[model samples]
Target: MGFLNAVGNVGLALSVAQVATASFYIYLEWYAHGKWTGHPGMQEMKKIAENISSSSFSTASTSSDELEFLRSHPSPEGVASSIDKEFRRMEKFVAFAGRGLTSSWSGRRIVVTPSWILFSHRTTFLPICQLLGHLGAVVVGTRCINNQIASLGEDEEQERADPMLGSGVVMATIRIADMDSGACMLSFDLPASELENFRLYLCCPLVYAQGVSLEPSIIQRFLEAFSAVVQENEPIEIPPSMELERCIGCLSNQTSVAIRRSCAGECGSCRCRPMWCEMCVGRWFASRLAQSHVPTSEWVASRVPCPTCRSLFCVRDVISLKRAQY
Candidate 1:
């Protein structure tokens, strides 16, 4: 479930980032074309400029229609071509920013580009970084790297030897600051593969967590706590019955069954079968909810109703069956 949520967020971030990049360029184009004349401040500035020019030389006053023409007409061909080139460059830059998350780059030193630094202020960018960090990438902010380099001195070699650096690693350098001192924090390298399952430290939105301390010990504790919570909440597996080939809900001979109702009481008066693959059951549940006029918040009150008998079942009544063969 957590993995799915992370994947969904990544897709969403990519979409939003693309739209924002396009909007930014569109605004720049508008500014360059004098479309900003619609603003009262711009009109005042234009009047001042005209007065200064008229006093020096008897020039014909520009008309509102002329101003409107300037705003609507395209700039010179050279200027239009230049803006088109810039648009392409901006697209490439946006793609490069998201490359770390969508593609694997092993053994490469990922530097924070100026474009990324500028866009990092957007809310979408941080989540993309956080998701990548959670997926075993080592993110080193710009401030932290500067601080670490400044303090190198005699410990430079020692820092290099720190077990964190390893081959085929995805390392990211960012800019983060210390909460209390407002000073840039120190940076460190890490083996990306080793941190694949390390969620706690990466899930905290470290990029934006100005209030939280970034000390190694504190980060270690956070990881430990997250691991404990995950372990405690892990669902127990139940042995499958002989009738696993057929879905209890639709009696369909699907190859994979995602959910199994092990508890009899939860079925209540429902005559529908208990075994169900995600697709079949999910559609039924969604359709049932869609037909109702209830608010989304209240839909959960209905629980997961059995498609056949309309009996409600709590989430605990069902267990997800793994498709993997032990």
Candidate 2:
């Protein structure tokens, strides 16, 4: 009985130690960012928000750590006001949108003032904001290829396309490190479009003054594959008898794309009429691939399902609809 009690006590202690160690490391990551609220597990939270592609923020808060740091010097309010004005004019993005976890999609929003680079998120209460003054390096998070373009249930044809094909930028993660310590301070994922704005806004020697080189992200070269594949097929013209309707996806634009199964793959015959715009349909296809954790580069080469009918289709099937002339 004494030996058994000793073994059990030791096992309990080890288990408690492991749990404490894990919780400590988790808290450290959050502390490194700031005293922010709502702590979600980093890796788990990333999976939930990984597909959010686009810019999201342009405003600043007076309570930010940067403001306090700036105030430590002379003429605090003056500096803060100037920074605030510039930040407002800069437009915001949906980078890790709080509402996005439930619904809605948005992307990269990083504001650069003279003294600091502001990173903010849309939270329930005061937006969880942070500031980084150090200039370090940036790196991408992730890529692929195409082969047997198979429709749903065509396992033999779906050989996981060439992993090397396409620009290979699925969900690009931009890792921003600190200059002083060379430690990663902030890192987030952004879609292809928002990356353009990121490079443009920070085009200066200071960003790379520490001899930093950036990792390749969702550059246009990678996106050109998607565009090329999408453009490979011609648009399908609608007859005068068929009336165009608002897109079900956006509910704003007229339905301009039709999914008439034209791919050589064994795609199911979709009888549904055109009810989606080209952009919405394309985005929907991309989102489907992303949500499935598939490689972004194999997008055009891969087959997808019709947004409405669930019938399998490929990029070639997405035909832009044009009204017939009288």
Candidate 3:
């Protein structure tokens, strides 16, 4: 074969390989988390919350834990208590970090607290966020494509089921959501030049929250692929801005009437704003509550300085982030 032809074949092969690898990652992620068919685990969790017949609580406070109220609660109340307790525990350390992190059960949108985003910038963590954001965008985008293809008026068997065809886009979407949601965890210390210190936390959608860990290979490959895409295609950036119309510190921590009543801002209660990523924050709360440390109002009040400009903005201002679209 001619040299130029050989080079063309190699480029095509690499492109095909990239797509295939991306697809495999998505399928495995969906399969592991049981998200392919509308999140069976989350559905079960919801069912457990609704099940009045069960005497045994799906999530209950242990006797050793100091929070005895949760121990005394019934199954439904106990589960809600569990979510609140654990969420507080995991986020307690993070409460003082920055503003804009939100957790709202009423609206079903856990926004990345502005504090966390600003902290990333303060600590020079934008690259990490960007990488994760790109990953989320690709993954979600791929899912969108697959869903589109499946809906194209063809029989399920006849239409292509192969995720490889649109996997790159899927992975990209997932990364974007990860960054946007603020569930993308980064190493505490990374060199100024290298953003290799990031790993998707359990809060990430594709990874199982119950079984999450730092595995560098896949994340690295995804980053490299995404970078190449940007270098080659030069796509336009979609400026995103969050509108936080209310005080971040004023939000009710739990959706429960009892918890909200007890902890509402009017009651001299400090509210824990929602984390940018609700699912991630929910899982974080669940994990922490299992250990038993209710988040406090004071801890949530302390705010971190912005990483970029080092400006101190109120939680409300942080929530309402406005950026130029161009």
Which candidate number has the best lDDT? 2
RMSD of 1: 25.2
Q: What is the TM-score of each candidate against the true structure?
A: 0.21, 0.35, 0.19
lDDT of 1 by residue, 1-326 (tens): 99999999999999999999987875664454656533333333354334334433233222223223323432433222332443444122221222332112122222222111112222211211111111122244222221131232322432222223322333334334433345543333323221222221222223423342243432243334433432333343435543456443223335333333444453454444445554344434433443453454454334566644556753334444443434
Local distance difference test, candidate 2: 0.50
Worst 10 residues of 2 by lDDT: 48-57
List lDDT for all candidates, in order: 0.36, 0.50, 0.30
Model 1 misplaced regions, further than 4 Å: 1-243, 246-273, 322-326
lDDT of 1: 0.36
Model 1: clashing residue pairs?
140-172, 140-173, 140-174, 141-174, 141-175, 142-174, 142-175, 248-273, 248-275
Query: For residues 1-326, could you state the per-residue lDDT of candidate 3 as single tens digits?
Result: 69999999999999999999987885675455653422333333344444323444334321223224433443434544454454454233231111111111112212132111212322121212111122231222212224233332221222332332332122111233334355643212111111121112321223322232333433244334433322333222324553332222212232211011121232322233322322222222222322343443322232333322333322222221124475
TM-score of 3: 0.19
**Backbone clashes (count) for model 2:** 19
- Which lDDT value does model 1 have at 258? 33
Order of candidates by lDDT, top first?
2, 1, 3
Backbone clash total for model 3 is 50
> Which wins on lDDT, candidate 1 or candidate 3?
1
